[model samples]
Target chain A: DAMVIQNPRYQVTQFGKPVTLSCSQTLNHNVMYWYQQKSSQAPKLLFHYYDKDFNNEADTPDNFQSRRPNTSFCFLDIRSPGLGDAAMYLCATSSQTFGDTQYFGPGTRLTVL
Target chain B: GESVGLHLPTLSVQEGDNSIINCAYSNSASDYFIWYKQESGKGPQFIIDIRSNMDKRQGQRVTVLLNKTVKHLSLQIAATQPGDSAVYFCAETDSNYQLIWGAGTKLIIKP
Candidate 1:
């Protein structure tokens, strides 16, 4: 099936350490997104990539960064993971149109120690 | 910062009953609305969506209603099952392609 896939379903990192999560899509969507979700809260958009153009949310912290090396792959890099950064990181992909629905990966659960 | 929010935090329904989850959006320019379902330890799955031009859209066992006048969006699930227990969220995207998301509503199915 054409779907979004994330690596390391669960990750544990030490405080102030760097961590990277990866996402790949067989769906071949043009736009890919990264979202951070804390317990019982909304999945907040961190950043997204439209081809090679990266769009970061205004409120996203400087520690968070993303890279889309190609059409099928994207990566989220946290320069310094904090305890507050412990959350589920979701990767989603969608068509280029405004109203297109997004398909999601299973998500990576990050635990900062 | 703009936001999409839910009217309720939790909803409980019995099996075979129907469930309705409501959301409110801030941006009037948002033309696309989607409903998502998230089970424990998983990503948000797309349920249904409605365009601003339409008041309602239906899917397999779900219906999405959008009331532009009030900026209210709703997801209705028929024949609720234990498998349907999860968090439901609503998201809206403006013409700019930025999708504003709502705090989700947790749905509990009672057997």
Candidate 2:
């Protein structure tokens, strides 16, 4: 079974346009994370939600926003995407237990033109 | 400020041979470590993990070694296969539960 799911495996958006990527999980985890990964680079932490308490990374741009309406759903919203925003967006979920392992979705690849 | 990094960016290994990937982390406060495998166009999948109290853990065909003294971590694959060819990353987290990731090591399978 797919524990974590992201819609629209691939997305293309015009520059300065708004885009939203959705993530859903069946694991019923308490934590959800969003990461941005460029080619040949590590995944950068964008933000995460610990049961509706949104936590944004220090380097995360203001253009990026997230909403977790419930434990099973989380959304990543880019107010205005730029060409630099083109990358693989990954969604992960984890429980709060000690030594908790994070489960990741297939990921959504975003392309900006 | 603290981060995790791989010793090598890429490694090529022969099929059926043992493969080892190494990582270094700067934070001594990190108590938990995990190894993730990311195939092309796919999200990272959890391979194995170890806590600070233990130095070693093993899974199917995979083993993770942690050296807290040098703050080094390594992943060993018993029999490298084509399916094992992917980017491997090591991540660490402290009490805060924020995971810091390494750049990753691309394991190439040589025929």
Candidate 3:
């Protein structure tokens, strides 16, 4: 069973188009996070949801938004995909504790044309 | 902002040999540190973690050493295997849930 799953392992979209990436976790973790990683660089936090509370990173662009309908599902919405936004988007989950180790899903590779 | 960092960007070792990866963090208040391994096309997988109160922690084939004095952390893998070849990253978290990540080190296992 996949602990965390991301649909469409690879996604391609045109510039300025709207695209959505979905993530679901079977672990029922209270904390879910979205990260954007390009090439070999460190993954940057876009936003997260702790239960139903949404937290956005200060540096995250306004074009990126997130929604968590329930405990098990989360979605990343790119209102206007840009060439710079083409990268691997990773989804992770963790418990409520600050030190709890996060479990990750296979990332979705996004390509902008 | 202070962030987690690593000295080396890549490491190479032979199979059956030991591998060591080093990381440094400037945030003295960070109470938790974690190590993750990411293979090509996959997200990071948790390998091990250490709490600020502890200086060292070990897993089945891995050991984590934390030197609060120097604000350094390290991961040691015993008898490295081919499957161990991946990008390794260190993350530090304060009392908050937000985590600061270090640029990963690519581990190359020579078989």
| lDDT score for candidate 2 against the true structure | 0.91
Q: If scored against the real structure, what TM-score would every candidate get?
A: 0.93, 0.94, 0.95
Off by over 4 Å in 3: B1-8
DockQ of each: 0.41, 0.38, 0.40
lDDT, candidate 1, at B53: 95
lDDT of each: 0.89, 0.91, 0.91
lDDT of 1 by residue, B6-89 (tens): 354889999999999999998988998999999999999989888899999999989989999999999999999999999998
DockQ of 3: 0.40
lDDT of 3 by residue, A1-113 (tens): 89999987999999999999999999989999999988878888898888999998899999999999999999999999988899999999998844688899999999998
Which docking category, incorrect, acceptable, medium or high, applies to candidate 3? acceptable
> Which has the higher lDDT value, candidate number 1 or candidate number 3?
3
Candidate 2 stretches with Cα past 4 Å from truth are: A97-99, B1-8
Interface RMSD of candidate number 3: 6.9
Cα lDDT tens digits for candidate 3, B54-95: 999999899999999999999999999999999999999975
Task: Please state the CAPRI-style docking class of candidate 2.
Answer: acceptable
